[model samples]
Target: MSLALKNEQYANELWRYKNTAGPQRQYFRMGLAAVLWRFLALHEGCVAAHCAVPGFGVVTTVPSTSGRDDHPLRTMVADMVGATRDRHRDLLTPAPNATSLGRTASPSRYTSSALWGENVLLIDDTWTTGHHAQSATAALKASGAGSVAVVVLGRHLNTTYGDTATHVEQARLRRFSWDACALRPWSHG
Candidate 1:
């Protein structure tokens, strides 16, 4: 199970900061890592059970289509889980021609190699349509990975609702409140 819901105020604030392209993004990334660490601390039994499994070699992340050399979540998760980042680096890569296909469209736009017989804990920032995670898992399995388990920071929610008794309108929804998670320090003032 994922740690949190993206529809929540704290998670949504972090998501917005993640999408921002500036120095502040780094701070948000650090904040996110701290939040994840706290969650893991609160769920030590879950972490212990996952760690007890044999052959759990390393942690890796789903590739980003933005062509970044590395994803912050990958690095942060590795640090939190006590895994070496470089060991699983380059395991999964996004195809050059990959496009941002929305949820419900699972495009084969990922590739993996050199993962034979390795057990990987795959991480992704958010779980949306899950196309990216599924594609990464399939590629890893096909490339002979012993196993792949996925973890996400948040699960995307479809928050829109019906306007009338019988008709539901699918409209974009945004939440501006920042009082959901007490750990979050920032707010929309």
Candidate 2:
């Protein structure tokens, strides 16, 4: 399936309702997305991926498609978390796992120094496909992010950590070691 479609499907399968407004739901959504971001960063072995701050809302850009503008997966992530857009640097370089993955984090007009604000969260409501996350991450990386991650509210059961809630929980646990929470999913058990 297409990344966009997949993201939608994943979002639908993972979430029963859209509770972006509730404090509990919002926290959980951001937390879940943050967890996924850390997981991908550690799994991908990219230092740039480690430094994300999991934003909470949507970031809309390019190719305005009617309802697509409102896709939960695309609309729910916060904004860029830490680094300001000015921090980003437009350099065409391959992400650490570029070889395994056909896509690359090449430079683009989205370049800006403020893009690399402090630890930031590229939040999303759900993960039906991951296209939204993928694109957002690439943009963040290109904008000069030391690390970038796409946080989402929900994930598929097959991909969920399952009974290892404790293990998974550890990955996201943080104690204000820095200005932003260091949710390193890779270290989780």
Candidate 3:
């Protein structure tokens, strides 16, 4: 679910070196909690067998490609209440040959545990080009996942980059609402 945005104006202070676990980290987690609830509720009855536990099998974050051990996002997810915390797992790790894998999608970017056909809800903190997220999905699928869904927390919008400035301008007209999804599903469009 590519629903949230991490724009500079509103979502600044997101985990930088000096300000690890940014001042507004709680807000981010709060928003994520709501988002996760909606997601699980919507997909509750649709989960299949061997999907780990109750549902969605497990909620795992994409490993930091930069090799930062024990990334803060994992801890944040681990502390989340309800089903999200209960279903968390450290499933994937960077592959042995994952060197120059840049902003291009490659299934071999990551290696995962034997899923044995579990439905996975893949979480990523920020989505820059979707390359890493997509790669993770492919890796999960290859590792015998049944259904894979990618939930990007921050669909980053670099205002100065290409059409993003225009996109932000257009988005400004609509008020942000938790009740309404930021990015509508295909059927709605």
Candidate 4:
């Protein structure tokens, strides 16, 4: 199930906050955590409750292609959901010398050999083509994970069409001011 539309200003802000590196990254990370927390709370029956049921062994994240061991989205989701760092394992690694899989690509960019027999709940920052998630899930199952479920912060959508592009532009302009500092609540600790 999708939570946010990629074209919306809030979602664009989230994507930018996640992908861009800067001083504001920390703030956006926290804001994203808060937003994700609220979303899970609202959809507890589907997300949190499902997790609470026994048999789900651990909560992990889709490994980032950036080569960073620590992913903000993964860490934040783990924190919000009460998953310890130990429980949130990085089971998958990027393929040998593979570069960032921009927009879309085959799922073979990642490889995993870790063994897990319990259920897994995978969290990701964004869903573009879902190749990342699909690849991770396949690896998990192949490695012996009983089952795998995915939750992503945003679903990216193409806005090339005239009407959709115009709507997205309007939403972006109306929902956010140019000066991000003014939007302190989203960044507040």
lDDT of 4 by residue, 69-177 (tens): 7777666866644433446666777776446555545456667666656877777877777888887787777778776777777776667644766765665574433
Q: lDDT per residue, candidate 1, 35-88, as tens digits?
A: 665554444334435545564466678877777665677767766443334445
Worst 10 residues of 2 by lDDT: 56-65
Candidate 1 to native Cα RMSD, angstroms: 8.3
Q: What do the candidate models score in CA lDDT, each in turn? A: 0.62, 0.39, 0.68, 0.64
Give the winner by TM-score.
3
Query: 1-189, model 3: which lDDT tens digit per residue?
Result: 342345453245344421335555566556656655665554443333233344577778898878688765676667754657888889889886675877899999998888887878888777778898899999888989878877665677666677877887887786654434433322211
Would you give me the overall lDDT of model 1? 0.62
* lDDT winner between candidates 1 and 4: 4
**lDDT, candidate 2, 1-58, per-residue tens:** 1011223454543453343456755664454445444443333233243543343222
- lDDT-wise, the better of 2 and 4 is 4
Clashing pairs in 1: none
